[model samples]
Target chain A: MEKKKEMVKTKRAQKKDNKWTQNDKVFLYILIPILILFFVFNTLQLLKGFYYGLTNYKGYGDYSFVGLRNFIDLFSDARVGKSYVFTFKYAIVLTIIVNIISLILALGLNKEIKGKSVLRGIYFVPNILGGLVVGYIFSFIFTYILPAIGQMAGITFLQNSILASTKSAWIAIVIVGAWQGIAMNTIIYISGLQTVPEDVYEAGMIDGATGWEKFCKLTFPLILPFITINLVLCMKNALMVFDQIMSLTKGGPSQSTESISYLIYNNGMSGGQFGFQSANAFVFFVVIVIVSFLQMKFLGGKEEQL
Target chain B: MSENMEKVTKEAVEGAVTNENEGEAFAKKRRAKHKKQSGPVQGKTVNRVINILLALGCLTVLFPLYMTTIIAFKQPSEMTNDISGALGFPAEWKFENFTEAMRVTDFWHSLGNSILITGVTVALCILIHSLAGYVIGRKMIKLKAFKMSYYYIVSGMFVPFAVLMMPLVKQTAQIGIANRFGVIVLYTVFFMPMNVMLYTGYLKNIPTQLEEAAHVDGATAWQTFWKIIFFNMKPMHATVAILTAMSTWNDVMTPLVIMAGTDENTLPLAQLNFQSQFGTNYNLAFASYLLALLPILIFYIVCQKQILSGVVNGAVK
Candidate 1:
């Protein structure tokens, strides 16, 4: 160890004397290709997306720069407005539902319960499965199995497929989304709950604090960061929800569930409203950045208080 | 009798004092026993309630999976409109549903495609991202350019893929890689920012002295990296590989848009394409979904402990 430390010191001295070393060459060789790829795929695509937003370009040959025409159309376009609304509504509702259920599960799992590991494993199964497949499975459940059970039980609401009606379709989507979404959040919250030292609870015990008080005053404050992460992640994912929507409803029943992402893909790639959708995509991008920023600012501040 | 009782009480008190001073473990055991004797009746009931509730929650979580499995095995004739039809087991478990699913979806072909895509993307991500991370992580403090580049790449985290979907569709075709290969390249790039962040953050703990020692031994930069740095990054590799593999395996959009006209199909895309054609023949659809799910499911079941912890580690970053 001593020899190695001495050697490191000597090497640093030699490196300071040399203007261009073998390491510099290695750095450039590695960095240049990565940067080139990044520029081509990521940077170029972003610029092209922004530029295309200004053009009258279809997916094909010729186009003229229309200069914010697509942006102008975006505001008045009822479909765009509807998608934005749906996305926000879905994001907000799912975020709250998912976090609550996950926190509850996490709290339960954190206790010295029997078969806790097994229970956790089962809850986490949904996270590993693909969203599209889960959506399809749930689609069948909603379409057939629930109605069958409802008919058998004589329950009026369940007798009909909830997905068939636009009013209740989003509810079905939310059910499936929450089922799958809570797994990761629960895992995260469990991890956060585990971080609370046993001695802190012992301290609470000395103060004669009830379970609920202990959680609100001690556990809640400690895990606020994890909560922040879960909320931000859930909200972000909900906004970009595509796979489940694709499999379940395809943004259907008169496009009531058309998320911003679904709208972009449906119109931009296949609908040949490429240029117009590009403008919408740009706006969606800005919204996400702002939402993330706001979440960080708000939640991060709350975290700092404790 | 009174004198004997006094002696017994004094000895018991002394024993308790000694246990407190020198036998923490013994004291803990005694306290545990005391608590159990006093409170176990109510505690047991509460535990039972929690257990029942959790069991129900587990049932809800597993319900879709159970339905999928049963429906996959059922014969088409058995798939009636009633609850019994959906719930009842098959008289003879039809393994051929899987075979038919494979045939309809070209299961081997798509499975091979999914594996190839995931395998190659994971390999490239580890190889390329680690190198970039090493360079940027080590040199960013000294070089202003590296610092700028770090921020530049990390900023891509905020850019949603939807924004780039249209332009990339056109761009990939124009570049003549509107196929699996192109998708592979794009996946490598798509995952760059996050993976780089993970790797660079990880590299902070790996000391520079190891590299200096290798340099003193006349080893080249590449040699040092291949021999020392790569192996040191095993934990991060597990995190990155699992994350990349899961996403690449399950992803539907990239293949949908990029591999549109191509004959190649990832598992999700194949299942999707066959979905409408199967229509009411859900036995076949369920079978295909199971088959698509089988590989990842097996992978998860095996490495679940590692995967779960890795997810927590990755999410924090």
Candidate 2:
């Protein structure tokens, strides 16, 4: 009788296990198809970009592989040349200014002040607005507000325009980009700042450290990780910017302000040089991947200290 | 009774002797120090100065929007000659610019296209990404190897939309979904990483025990998820939905690149087209841009609290 009872219990447990296995199998069947669709589609989309880069193909059905011809043409293309210069210049300027301004805002809000949250809200409001809307508003500001300010300052030449010239157009783009990005970056920096323990600050103060000393030693060093994350992401994003430029400048004043992405877009879609755009895009992809990889590696090395 | 009372009094006297004098002096000095620190009715001067400076900076940031609002309402002559006058609240408010802009830009069709595309994109992205996010977040599932796939997807965020636009356009042409909801779906794929990150991060904090319990209580996996896990992820859902909506609704690039040569242009692209139509008409262009931004701004304002709270809360977590 005892043997039979044990056998029954074991069999029942086995049956439950079988039921679970069946349930899991059913779940997997339902999920795997969807997962594969997304994965396969996205992977193909990305990989095809690279594959198409090497081809001397047009939009139609037929094409042949042309090894590095697209790249060679890319280097020689005057439009691509202008875009490269403009994009790099804009990225550098925008990255540095945005970081500094956001960091400053973060530090300011980090202090024990009244209405700090409200101040934060006010600053971050622009970020919530769509980039296109922000671009549109900036267009008017460039056309209208800056001129008025210039007039008030008695600077007649500056009063005449804000974004007509190549140099001025670049400046306007950077300023608008910085404005749009500052709020989120400020929030990220603030998040970083909060990680500095109060006791650490007190300890610094106990050592007779001044405010600046405390910030430089305790705050800045501690926030390096956040800085890295913010910097890399910002740099990558600024490099790939399109909407605002397309809206505000449209690579205007003779394509003086056209970035790589904008150039790729205009050439491929409007100009119908599909394969040429693909090559430009592939180069952009490689550049992004390399830069991001290096950034990750550098940060990875510092992760030990963090 | 008298002898006991006398003994108690003596002990109390000794206790007072030991404790009172030092305590009294400490309290007196502390009170004196507090009094000295408390100056009569003065505010924090440093805070005031700092706040004033910050307010000024914030105003400068907002100055562009303020000026635009003014310009969108002004007359063409005002816009041309006196940019300042154009950039002020009209002395006599004219709402006709908005009407004129709508009529001139075929605003209805453009608005409808934007709504359809953005709505479809947000819905599909949320659905697909949440499923993927859930799979990644719920590691108890047998598909544990899929976490690497999620990481791969996350890295896709770094791929510039430009890099993919060319091939994406071509691929869309092949798939025959280029101009319509195809661009919308592709946008979802491209933009999924950020939304996935948000969802997965949120899901991590939720204990798996809830779903397990629901499962053990004879619920199917789907039921357990929808009934238990999904219901619990309100904050994450709000954040993702609002953000996805905002981005898709505002996106010009995808429509510009993919939807080109088609009549399926969204609001931002329509605005671009509007610019072409009335390129030289500064008033009409400005007015159209304002019209494009208004509905979005309204939506954002209405959802502002939820969006801000969701982000702030997510950050805290």
Candidate 3:
């Protein structure tokens, strides 16, 4: 009798599980709408972007499909090449500068200091301001204030506007980018520092570890994950640089500062090279994917080793 | 009574002896040892040096803002070509610059547009993404379909917005939504991958037993989610709201493309459009920039604690 009852209970449970439940209804109710919107907005657009790359369709009128010609053209185009070179260079430099400054700021702020929160708030102010506005503000400084100071101090380099020169224009962008970029990165690092337990520092002290030694041995290893996060975030943001370039240089000084995104927006959308820029955008996408994948593999390996 | 009084006095004496011998002496020794150990790490000199460095850092960060404020108050005539003209306070405060800036940018209209866009985008992101996250988070463990869907959604994170820019413009125009409405929808969609990841990760810590209990008590899945699970995800909501709001508020590209040729303009868009018109009129331009910055700056100031913590939480996850 006991065996029969157990078998019957199992059969009932299986029946209930197989039957459509209210949970499934709720799940579909939520999932279907999101999937629909996702399809219409994201997935569909991506596929269309890929298709647009193969054609010579301008923004307005239709045109014949250009096949692999656009993609082929991307190889020999000097402007495209220049942009890629500029973008990669900017991304690398900005990433390094931002990480270093933010890390140092984080370390200092993590100490017991008066008005720590207030100081942090001040630093983070730039991050909250719109990029365009910040760009405009800094543009004025680069144009007016810096030059004035330069003239007053009799510094030849400072007397002229940096944005007007191709060689120094990119550096100005990096400075502004780093100024805003450091804020969030610093906050991330501080949080990482907070995660290192007091006991670990105590143990380090007991073992006669110096301040630098403790940071290197104890704090750095514990915060490796945060470093990876910051690095990846910083790299991705740097590569897609747009707004500051727009307001500051307009990709001018002979298009020396045209990032990949800026190029796409300028040429593809407004400049009526939609199909060609689409191909460029597609290539840019693949580059981002490969770069991100490599970063993950490299950084993820380091994280594991630590 | 005399016997009881004598016993109490003896116990008090014993307590005092134990406190002095064990507690006070040990505390003093530990305090001294702590000071000795922390001397190098937390020395007065080291702290003072760090503080001085930090103060300098703050000044550097504030320098541009200070310049902007001073320049905005100075007249075009007072804005001489020299450093003193740039650095010194305006001879007389020119509050008219702000009025001119407001008039030029249609400041109130664009401000409203920005607030509306940000508010709606944040609300929709929280609502749709959290529900999607909860469902995926709960069911992905048992269902293969849910797991695949989760991956499908999360993969959007790696795709850069530039790749989608041109195509999205054409698509939105085709769909007849290439306006502020379209921008809001796109913002919600753009933020989904990161927000969903955050939400699903948060949901893992919420115990399944609560849902099971609700099920046993004859509550429907909808009721269970709304009543129990939704409220449990407040911190994650704050994280999503803050991250989405910041990006949406400060964003320029989406509004620029989507709302092109429309009468509507977000704050950033207005500033960009009027930039050339305000060219060389540093006072008006600076005033306009400050006006554009004020809303988000004030928001940040009021919610600094939550905003900072929210960013940390979102980034770490």
Docking class of 2: acceptable
**lDDT scores in order:** 0.87, 0.73, 0.86
Instruction: Tell the DockQ for candidate 2.
Output: 0.34
- Please give each candidate's TM-score: 0.91, 0.84, 0.91
What's the candidate order when arranged by decreasing TM-score? 1, 3, 2
Q: lDDT tens string, model 2, A84-189?
A: 8899888888889989999988888877666777667768777766677678667866876678778888987678566898668888899888988787678878
Model 3: per-residue Cα lDDT at residue B43:
57
The local lDDT score (0 to 100) that residue B29 gets in candidate 1 is 48
- Give candidate 1 misplaced runs (Cα > 4 Å): A1-22, A304-306, B1-44
Candidate 2 regions with alpha-carbon error over 4 angstroms: A1-24, A60-62, A76-78, A144-162, A300-306, B1-43, B140-144, B309-317
Compose the digit string of candidate 3's lDDT tens values, residues A1-306: 566556555754874777545576678787988988988889888888889999998888868898999999999999999999999999999999999999999999988887788778888888888888889988988998888878778999988999999999999999889988999899999998898889988989889998799989898888999999999999999999999998999998999999999999999988989999999999998999899999999998776232
Report per-candidate TM-score of chain A alone: 0.94, 0.87, 0.92
Task: Flag clash pairs in model 1.
Answer: none
* Candidate 3 per-residue lDDT over residues B1-317, each given as its tens digit: 22332343344345445544544455565577576864753355455456656766776666777777778778888877777778677888668999999999999999999999999999999988999899999888777778898999998998888899999998889889999999999998999999999999999899886886676667887788889999999989999999999999999999998899689999999999898776768889888888887788778879999999999888888
Cα displacement (Å) at residue B301, model 2: 2.8
Model 2 C-alpha lDDT per residue in residues B106-190, reported as the tens digit of each score: 7888899988887888778777777667766664333445566567778877787777777777777777877877777777787
Please give the TM-score for the first chain of candidate 1.
0.94
Clashing pairs in 3: none
Worst 10 residues of 1 chain B by lDDT: B1-10
lDDT of 1 by residue, B106-161 (tens): 99999999999999999999999998899889889877778888998888888878
